[model samples]
Target: IVYSWLFWYHSQLLTMKTEASVLVEVLDINDNSPVFENHPATVPVPEDHTVGDEVTSVNATDADSGFNGEVRYTLLGSAGRFSVDQETGVITLAAPLDRETQDEYRLVITAQDQGRPSHSATTTLDISVTDINDNAPIFSKQQYEATVSEHAEVRTNIIDIMATDKDDGENAIVTYHIVKQEPSSTPLAFTIDEESAH
Candidate 1:
């Protein structure tokens, strides 16, 4: 460092400034929420509805920035039953629906943004599967049968059973299986139905 003396009038002196710089801070706002136009939207459809049939619609909003505000839709549960369009927020029925077999569906959906810290939101969707009598009856006791004694008391307890099928076709035919009490077993039984066992 060098100290030079200029025109020192009355022994008074002062200095001038030299360099400077600027800084900035960024903040985040509520940009997006994985939500639908309505919490639970409804779409009436026939059991034989086409694949392209529009099931329902949902929408998401983001206040961040371009593309950052862009949202994508995703169906989290029972996907084979329905689907969502990422851009249009439109949902379409993927397969046939039978309220008898599966009355209603509760779905989880997410909306996410393409950002550095990526933000997302989750929401539940209630889908009511309308009835169409499309589901055929299924036999729980496929190939099982029981022998009842001639003197057996009426309404005697038998066994428990159930059945299910993906299609509403005759493949859903109802039948039952009953393994009667053997020599090592106790009494015999009788009675059957598609609904229950006794």
Candidate 2:
């Protein structure tokens, strides 16, 4: 009876029972940007970490959901001495690191989002490594020697030698090269520091 009445009195009924549904839509917002939890992450690799040695990583995170959360890494500024994975964020040492020539390096890493006109974030890294004494010191003067006056003070400046190297890390270790002094030459004729004055 009620079904029949509802069908017959639909146009005339003022107060009656009715069923309705509601629909809502949501929009996306750029509430957050990519960030590096810890800036200046660092690591050390052998002067020669083989051909495929994973050096370090650049960790980045996004606060958005879905595709917006996807982050990609890029080695910006200068891709020298390192390479970063676009997907995994793994940074690998491409060339050998020489501490004698370049003991430290500062790199900038960028993280971009997947969204259109994707947002980006950048960070700086301070990479410091130890010397391995692997690189043979190069005699800047090639070959040169001098003799001081026999009456000169026992302690005197005999020679000032310089050296250079090309490596990615500490493996480019450095030391002094004296090549045996003459009988009259003092034992303290030459000296070298582990750190580059640069």
Q: Count the backbone clashes (under 3 Å) in each candidate.
A: 9, 9
**lDDT per model, in order?**
0.64, 0.66
Give a tens-digit lDDT track for model 2, residues 94-178: 7777665777677788898887767889998766655665655554777766677877775466655567665434545555544
Write the residue-wise lDDT of candidate 1 on 1-198 in tens digits: 223333422423645434434344455544554344554554455566677788777778777765667788778885588888878778788777765567667767788877656788877777766545465556555675556677767776555566765554454555555545444434443445635544
Q: What are the models' TM-scores?
A: 0.49, 0.56
Q: Candidate 2 — which residues are off by over 4 angstroms? A: 1-25, 39-41, 77-79, 137-198
Error of 2 at 196 (Å): 22
164 in model 2: Cα distance from truth in Å? 12
Clashing residue pairs for model 1 = 31-62, 31-63, 137-172, 139-175, 140-162, 141-177, 144-177, 144-178, 158-198
Model 1, which residues run further than 4 Å from truth? Answer: 1-37, 41-45, 133-198
